[model samples]
Target: MNERITPASDPSTWGRALDEAVNILSRGGLVVVPTDTVYGIAADAFTPPAVQALLDAKGRGRQMPPPVLIASVQTLDGLATGVPAGARALAEAFWPGGLTLIVRAHPSLAWDLGETHGTVALRVPDHETALALLARTGPLAVSSANTTGSPAAVTAQDAYDQLGDSVALYLDAGEAPGQVSSSIVDATGETLRLVRAGAISLERLNEVTPVEGPTA
Candidate 1:
């Protein structure tokens, strides 16, 4: 049975919820957590089996890797290499929000996110609960909490209906503000390319840095 945690409850309860979520993640177990955009299924990014299990839960394949949710913008450097000036500028402008930067992975990092092509997508979600959990678990490989090709879950219950017992814990912060997914920008190359457009509009991205490619 999955543990359902409402973090908005009393103080002691919130602490217990956080502890449960952290313990599950540390053991390479998957959890459904709230994000600014939507509910996300998260697992320890450093654990290959955990990451693979997340994919299996979603009925997804290695071709589509999950994005890494971070606690702070400062953690970006340790996970990615050759960060571009524009990427840094964008992070400063839109971080702690919906913006995923695809950058080259650290050469010596011993984690496989599957078909990442030597790169990793990193983001700092705007939700407090997610940040708090991320602060404890380091980085989590997170994706929309739904089966592959299904609509993203906007609430923990919606996620549970689909994911069921696959996730070890569910951090329910009520319904999420269902918005577009994070805007993805490939910063690994010299020219910043827009891979997917979502909450962050193209105009907004251009304001931070000159982004190339067709909008999603």
Candidate 2:
């Protein structure tokens, strides 16, 4: 059975919530959580067993690598190596919000982050409760909280209705703030390019990246 957690920016019971979330994560349990954009199901990034469980819960294949969420941009260096200037620029621009940056994995930390060949997608969510949870749990492997090919969850009820007994915890911080997912860009090469476009506009992305490339 999963527990329903009401999230708050300045949570009166944040300490308790954090304790529960951390314990669940450390024990490799799946957690359905809210982000600045959409609701995501998270597990410990370092645990392959937990990752496979998350993929099974979402009905997603290995091809759809889950993005990792960390407490702060400072933690990026610990996961990925030589983050490019453009990548850093965007993180500075839209971090602690809805933007996923793909970067090369550090050789030493490579085994834990899973199969990206050599790259990993990372984000720092803009929600206070989410960040607070991440700060304690370290990096978590997260993806939209829904079955593969289904409409992503935008509320705690949406998550519960779909994920039901699959997850260990359902953090219902009300509805997803943006009602959409983060715009993703692969910064693995010389140029930053779009992998998925949702909330953040391409016009806005151009402001950060050079305006010359095919829009995927």
Candidate 3:
């Protein structure tokens, strides 16, 4: 059975909810959690089966790999290798918000997030509940909590309606601030390239580092 949790409740209640969500994730189960941008379906990134389950829930293929959400900017060094100067600049300027940096994945790590081509997209959301959960669960393979080609869920109910019982836990923190995803920048290249334009504008990204035109 699926469970709905309100992370905005009292401290003790919120703590329990976090525990439950963490427990589910530790067991290779999926959860629908709120981010600064939108609700996301998340699973343990290190567990290939769990990651695969997230893809199955979204009815998506390996070609579209899910990004990893982290609790802190410091975690980036552990997950990614060859972090460019532009990536660090962007993270310092826009992390804990809506900016995702795609960098080369650390070769030492053992996990499959599907067709990443040796790269991993990572982000640290600005939401308190998301950060709190990430603090406990570490990195999660997270994608917008909706079927492929559908509108991203801005509320937990919307996520539940689409994901149903496939998600073990739903942390309902009310509506998300934005309906858009994060601005994706490819940091693995010699020069930063805008992969997807969203909350963060191209002009803002260029202020920190030179950004090439949008990808084809």
Candidate 4:
């Protein structure tokens, strides 16, 4: 099928664009969407095949699983088990912004995001268009909108150029607000470890709760 690019910011097309994105995701298709940090390729989180397809599109492997994006902080407990006190404080302080937390997944959930090793990375993007899409589709398994070794996309066209027909649709709401990705913290253990440094600094994260550097 041919790729479809929708102008998500157009008042005349906003509703239609969202509906089409929701339809595409419902069918387990891929979509390139704008977020506060950068563009991302999104798929239904619960669909294993769809998640695998997204990994394939980026030439990524099962070792590096995609993060799940939720519309709100309330959804965290629904997806993750044993979320730490620091993690909850961090979420309350900086959620709906650029911070990703890695915690143990609820064992009963039936979804394969590939080699998560019982842990799932979750984020709540601070972009209206992304939030709108998440509101309709629930949690989405999303990765940066770029092929392996390429820079993450800042605009829909950039994502399209890299992803092409691999993505079913591109939600173009213009450039993403930030070029940096979200800072990732692993909260499953006794200490919160900063996994990947990005938009939020370690100092800033510590202001809310103690965050240590990556494990040796």
Candidate 5:
């Protein structure tokens, strides 16, 4: 259970920190990273063992799989399929913020995300440190950096306290914004469905494209 913590707050340290984080992801390791909404535990999306380790660290089984974080909004098509026009509109408007789009997984992808039911949830985070890591690591399977039913980690220390040595490294970029988690939408079907409401409101979402909630 060996672990390392790297401070990524300083601009000068970003180069070194990102390099180390990239290396860790390359070899199937988990890292606690600061995101716009909260800190998340990340692993290489294409590495089955690493993804499994992430799920294990969070105490969630295959039924609750982690979402994939991408470097850019354009990366969505490469990983997911059957993305409707409405989903694209939403991605264009709220991406790099806190919107998670759940679309059908690309048929050609070789990786296994566990009981995904052919769907993959994807987002492009707004935080600089998280984006820098994603730019180098491509897509990472990431989830809230806390155990099941626990408060989401808002800092690297919060994550380390719960995850302990299960993670290979913790990228400390100071406290996360800690406002709200990303809003999720299910776009695999004909109509867009609101899976979870968080930072982005349903009203704001409908401004871009119509969305259905429980009431709908």
Candidate 6:
């Protein structure tokens, strides 16, 4: 069953909550966590059992792979390859924040990360708790903490309401900032392409990188 931890804003409670979350993760358990955008159910990226548990909890199909969250842009180097110059620029400009990137995965992955036909989706979340957890666990495979085809949860209660006892831990950092999920960009090329649109505007992306239209 899922248990709701106190708000992470409280320094003392926050430390306990973070420690418990990390312990659960290290033991291959799933945690419903807060991110800059929405609540997501996360598992250790390198653990096959953890990945499977996350997928099973979501009742997700293997055809659609989950996205991985990295602690920083530097973490991307080890898990993925061919991170194009434009992608790096975007990461520098908007990382440690919203923005999921689809790039080629490193050849030597321990678990089945996803089926992007060789590509992987990665993001660096912009939350202290998220970053702290990532730093401790390395990287995490995370997706919105809701049943497939359901509206994303923006509050801990929403997550608890929908996910119920499916998750191991619930990190309630109060309500989310309410920003939509990051706009996805495929920058594995000289130009950036908008795969999905959200809080990060296309114009803003253009200001920093060449937000090119998709190529056939």
By lDDT, the best candidate is 4
- Candidate 6 ranges beyond 4 A from true positions: 213-216
Q: What lDDT would each prediction earn against the true structure? A: 0.89, 0.83, 0.91, 0.93, 0.90, 0.82
Error of 1 at 136 (Å): 0.8
Model 1 weakest lDDT span, ten residues long? 1-10
Ten contiguous residues with the weakest lDDT in model 2: 1-10
lDDT of 4 by residue, 1-216 (tens): 224778897656699889999999999999999999999999999999999999999999999999999999999999998899999999999889999999999999989999999999999999988998899999999999999999999989899989999999999988888889999999988899999999999999999889998767
Model 4's number of clashes is 0
lDDT for each residue of candidate 1 in 1-216, tens digit (9 for 90 to 100): 335645543445578888988999999999999999999999999999999999999999999999999999999889988999999999999999999999999989989999989999999999888887888889999999999988889888889989988998888888887456888999988799999888898899999889996655
Task: Give the alpha carbon lDDT tens digit for every residue of 37-94 in model 5.
Answer: 9999999999999999999998899999899999898898899877899999999998
Off by over 4 Å in 3: 1-12
Question: Candidate 2 vs candidate 4: which has greater lDDT?
Answer: 4
Which residue pairs clash within candidate 1? none
Candidate 2 lDDT by residue in tens digits, 161-181: 888887888787778889888
TM-score of each: 0.94, 0.92, 0.96, 0.96, 0.96, 0.92
**Best model number under TM-score:** 4
Clashes of 5: 0
Q: Model 5: what TM-score?
A: 0.96
Separately for all candidates shown, the number of backbone clashes (residues 3 or more apart, or on different chains) is: 0, 0, 0, 0, 0, 0
Better candidate by TM-score, 2 or 5: 5
Once fitted onto the true fold, the runs of candidate 1 whose alpha carbons sit more than 4 angstroms away are 1-12
Task: After the best TM-score superposition of candidate 2, give how far the Cα of residue 170 lies from its true spot, in angstroms.
Answer: 0.6
Q: Please give the distance, in angstroms, between residue 187's alpha carbon in candidate 3 and its true position after superposition.
A: 1.0
TM-score: model 1 vs. ground truth: 0.94
Off by over 4 Å in 4: 1-3, 10-12
